[model samples]
Target: MPICVYWGEDDFAIEKAVALLRDRVLDPMWTSFNYTSFPPEQADAAIQGLNQVMTPTFGAGGRLVWLINNTLCQHCPDNVLAELLRTLPIIPENSFLLLTSRNKPDERLKSTKLLKQFATEFREFPLIPPWKTELLVQSVNQAALAADVKLTSKTAQLLAESVGNDTRLLYNEIEKLRLYAEGSNKPLDVATVTQLVRNTTQNSLQLAAAIRTGDTAKALGTLADLINASEPGLRIIATLIGQFRTWLWVKIMIESGERNQQAIASAADIGNPKRIYFLQQEIKFLSVEQLISCLPLLLELEISLKQGASEITILQTKVIELCQICRGS
Candidate 1:
């Protein structure tokens, strides 16, 4: 084998590996190649093909890189590939082949007769799905380690909850925290975390609620709060209009016998999953006028915001106007 190879769904590990390759350590001999993708269907082709390319000694005396993936390895013919492998001995010193996949290698890996001999020195890292409860804490800690900072467990957990449990988002949030927390040794508490992290979720939630309640002042306040926090005014108005329209559409759909809130929530692709149950109660009494009247106000806000109208004022007017309609004013 050339040097090292990887197998996992861990994007972080793959990213680190890529960084090392990009840096290209000279004295100890290091190089890297990243593949576009690798999926399960291409497994057998990958094994035989990689074996040929990743060898111990280079004929030309330099490092080799064959970053194998689903598309690249899926169609290689077996016998011809075996012929390529026959030219190189089992262990080729100067070559390194790295393979990555979202899905872990399975029984095929364990049972593959061809790969059995090479399995001894093989480094296999499988990315396991994290428990929902522990995910945030783990993500924060991992981020801290990467940033070379000491993040407290409490701080880490708090930071994790602040950002949704998406690893990619968490990665971005942690980077922000690292920069803000620089030269500050104090463990990040919720207050510090909150100040540093923008709560776009709350902004979205409040804006949606303001639109729903039709309280123009509340709507304007929410918009102002968002703008003060550096969110684009146009995006806030647009997202609110979209979400409210979806809510109204689903409300109408439920009235027409599409009453299954879970089904509605799935189709709509917004709203808290928990809110699905609450929505049934809320939507049950929604009048067609409530939806009809609010739609124009929302459209007006969108148009005005887009047209460079005073977004804050338009939002405020829209909110108050919506509340009146919703409340049968």
Candidate 2:
């Protein structure tokens, strides 16, 4: 019950969780003496952490040994695993061992299995994909509830669209809205969220939509807005690749005579089977060939961005090409 494992792509959420755990486990007066952290760069951090967690508390509080950005879950050397096997069961009840990582622990790994058996808690803070609007809206609502801010359903949806999958921005915006709602009797409305939250509606998803519709002008415009907003070019390409890949999968499944929405959803990695209906409608005008063609262009765009080409120029050129492909021109 003294071992905890937290791994995920949502770094801000992980950091907040860690802070809460630190507060719960360590006495403020004795924190400096009792809390030991091994950053990823520290040599033999996992083994060192295992050793540290076995030590008795220094003062009046429980000891907490943290292995930050740990890779043991992904690949633990036999020696480290041996140490964990020896130390974990005997760790003092007054001491806690915490391992955190950005990568998911491989369930097949012996180290991960051992940690699962001993860990009191194992949690993942995965980032929601941008295309998953329903999940994003739900996350926004939950965050608003936590921040003690009231928001209309429309306002929650608006905030979700504005912030997308950025948990840090979502929390900061919710905090700002909470402060503004001090003594206000009404729930925050869409107008209020639109006024306060940075309007990032012109995101990569919007760019993808513009391309789907063969609107070269709109696609170019959205690309400009994203670049102007300082959105990373590689991130933009990544989103495009994911979006296009999903579309391609859906198209392939439908064209292959797969009628079951759940099957199509599963094939495309879509969470909601109902969403397949909407996606089918969106891509009805395009053939599988067109969707297939977008992938190479997207790959080229990604390569150009990585090679230090001008972001705006390369993005704009690729956007035009994608629009043409969708347009059958």
Candidate models: Cα lDDT each: 0.56, 0.90
Task: Kindly list the per-residue Cα lDDT of model 1 for residues 1-329, writing each as its tens digit.
Answer: 43334455566656666456434522233322322223445555555545545444423334434344332222335653464355234444544444444444443432223333343223444432221325446666877788766667776766654553445566777778778778987766766676777553445546666656656677667777777766666656555666566667667667778866667767756434555666556555557667777778778877888898986667666677777777673
Model 1 TM-score relative to the real fold = 0.45
Which residue ranges in model 1 land beyond 4 Å of their true spot?
Answer: 1-172, 175-202, 270-275, 282-285
Best by lDDT: 2
Candidate 2 lDDT at 178 equals 94
TM-score, each model?
0.45, 0.89
| lDDT string, candidate 2, 1-329, tens digits | 48999999999999999999999999999999999999999999988888888878877879999999999988989999899888888999989999999999999999999999999999999998888777898999999988889998889888998998899999999999999999887899877788889954688899999999999998888988998888889878888898999999999999999999999989988887998998999999999999999999999999998999988888888899999999993
Return the lDDT, model 2, position 171: 96
- Could you tell me the TM-score of candidate 2? 0.89
* Residue 223 local lDDT, model 2: 86
